[model samples]
Target: MNDRWMQGPQFLYMKEEDWPYTSRENYHAISEVVSVIPTSKFESWGKLLRVTAYVCRYMDALRGIKRENLALSSEVFQRAERVLYRHIQAESLLSELEFAASLRKVAKKTAQCSSIILSMKPYLNENGVMRSMSRINNAKWLNIYTRHPVILPDNNRATRLLIRHYHDKFRHIVVNEIRKKYFIPKLRQLLIRVRKHCFRCKMNVAKATPPEMAILPEVRVSAFTPPFSYSTVDYGGPFDIVHGRKIEKRWICLFTCLVTRAIHIEIAYTCSTDSFILCYRNFLCRRGTVRKMFSDRGTNFIGAEKLLKTT
Candidate 1:
């Protein structure tokens, strides 16, 4: 209802504290969008969950970064910004009007920064082929410092700090990761040669006294006698989301018979105790009663199991 709220940030990121209130709005928005737009609605729901996860992580990171006085866009900061933008869109933190206005500018700046860093990778081969800085051995510090001077201006303290950090992390190191990735074939060839040498030596050497082997005491193994022979009933069905005022197309709950491995399935209009009980009872009547059951600890399943046992 406040015009000032709309004008605060073009793409406002919501904190977890705001979730209770915003969820109502998000639910209504999703309903309106899903009813009219025939696009992949489930994808939108997945994005909502993803955004929530990202915001929670980012906010926590921001607290630490702010405390240390590090800039968000600094190369040395070492957090991926592309992921952040994706989170913003997924959470629907911004209204459609505000989102459309500011998305391009912020996204473009983040992408430009990434490109600048990506271009500074050192060329390892003499043939002008660009290789990772990690591939060159012996003089890694000198190689990176010389090749990526564009990223490290003498005057920029942040750039200087980044260069120092990079050196401290990896300078003078023979990068085993590069060797593992690119030199596996060479290692295989060397292994074959060594194996041949071992075989020849084994034939020439006199046989040494074999070490005495000792037999250990026998241990009894328990026979796996399961409490229940098998699940007499099994079923699988769709679960529609109905709580917290968010748009959800549907989810699935699968059931199985432990013993017989028989399956029953139904599509749920909404995932509720009633829906679960109806489907489960129908399955039992058709197949048979199960001796034991295994299901995800969802509320519906737990409640259904309790009610079923009572009857």
Candidate 2:
């Protein structure tokens, strides 16, 4: 490593290529921020910044300003949203939603009002924000914004972005918290759509994938074999059996035929190698010979097999 490299600045931000998914509204705000914020201070920092670093650093672009001059942290995001709304209006996109026909006592025939907005009783506030007219408009105890919540379009792209901004800023989408500021038509459906689109939330609520079936083993697939030809052995339980006055503990050594699905049970006195060997002999004597036996690697079963092989 070059020793002179240590002489450079401790921390620096390097700019990078354009972010494709960045909204046009935010892009304009980024431009607005870039115009006021000087790049000369970060001369040591590279010209192009990484995508992630850009997002992080953009938050603090106005950091060095004097206390009195510094804009509120929220103003940056609000400016972007305002720009977004302005762009929507210039395009005449939400014409039906812009004005409400039911606001006045007598409805005008020329007024173009959407059927969806009739029940909402929507009106424009002093700030020109579209808000719902509430019966509690006289309620001085609550905040004015709370009394008449901002009405948002259900299907607009801008509406989704605005909702995302609110959700990210506060981190909760609770009914009361959101109702204080905004209201949407069929809010339940809108929230569901938002949840579906969210990358992190969607991951947590993802649908479970069904496991694929495995290929059948040779013994199980062999249909022509007779009963006890290919046997699978397994222990059942240490069941209580009354012998005269005293009760004795015994295990059922279950032997099942793979081809015919016939089962043969043998009572073992204990779960030892000697007891298992005796059970195996009894099964063979009564049910004839077994060409192959499949079982889990239990200590008794393994020990019995080893002893039989050695003898």
Candidate 3:
């Protein structure tokens, strides 16, 4: 029937008691009722009430003439609920078993003796025994048969998991925390490896590796070059001196031959442009004029260069 027919006085005014009683005849009326029922009402209902209501509505929508169809519908619903519950339980159990297997693999790897463990043999209650047992002396300090099954070695699989889970903390922090509950052989090494490879730790702490050295400049590497032909100049410290019963300061202007590695030092009374010009004059008179000079961007050197250019 059309929605207009259902909305008319015939269906709208009809009492629940007057509606079709059997499932075969009540299909249209059940559909209309289900469509009009608010989804909120279904959500608010208890599980039992919800299941009951669902089954009743389903049975009403069935078109079979036999009364046994209602019983079959209830049986099918119950069976489906049981199957769904079993499926969920099976999935959960399967996941747990898989996790346990992974842990067992980790345990086996941890139990194996490594080079580091063998090195500790001398410290095993047999030689150079100390007064107190520490984590370092694993042979005497750890019961491998019992602890190995549960605890991993310092650089093993379990330690990696702990480092990643704990945000790649420092080795001391990770080792100290693990020591409280479990003893892992060479735990420090394992933690270090984890921290080294951990993406977060690498991003935060990694440094750029130095690239290969570039070819030396021609002025620095050339052979048989005259001294001071290519030179670098820089000012050194002011040295205290006694002159006429008064303390005075003098600066050393250092000129270095880039190719020959020869050095020339001249004393300057002050770090002014005039003083630098005088120093340069003394260097040029002694060593000849340099073809090129390299100096830091000092104001005195700049002024001297400008004076030389003008002269």
lDDT of each: 0.41, 0.65, 0.57
**Span of ten consecutive residues with least summed lDDT in model 3:** 122-131
What is every candidate's alpha-carbon RMSD to the true fold? 30.2, 12.8, 18.6
Query: Which pairs clash in model 3?
Result: 154-185, 154-186, 154-187, 154-190, 155-190
- Residue 189 of model 2, lDDT score: 71
The full ranking of all candidates by lDDT, starting with the best, is 2, 3, 1
Q: Please write out the lDDT profile of model 1 over residues 129-223, one tens digit for every residue.
A: 22234434565555442332211122222222322333334433323322332211233343333344454435656587899987632221112
Compose the digit string of candidate 3's lDDT tens values, residues 110-208. Answer: 433443332322121121111123344455565442222222334333234544554334433765555554445666666667677767767778799
Per-residue lDDT for 56-139 in model 2, tens only?
A: 344555454333534334554444443333343323324434445244434433335455655667765454556678889899
The residue ranges of model 1 lying beyond 4 angstroms of the native Cα positions read: 1-229, 232-253
Residue 207 shift from truth in candidate 1, angstroms? 30
TM-score of 3: 0.42
Most accurate candidate by TM-score = 2
lDDT for 55 (candidate 3): 55
Reference-based lDDT, residue 200, model 1:
49
lDDT of 1 at 114: 39
- List where candidate 2 sits over 4 angstroms from the true fold: 1-121, 124-130, 134-149, 153-182, 185-193, 199-205, 237-248
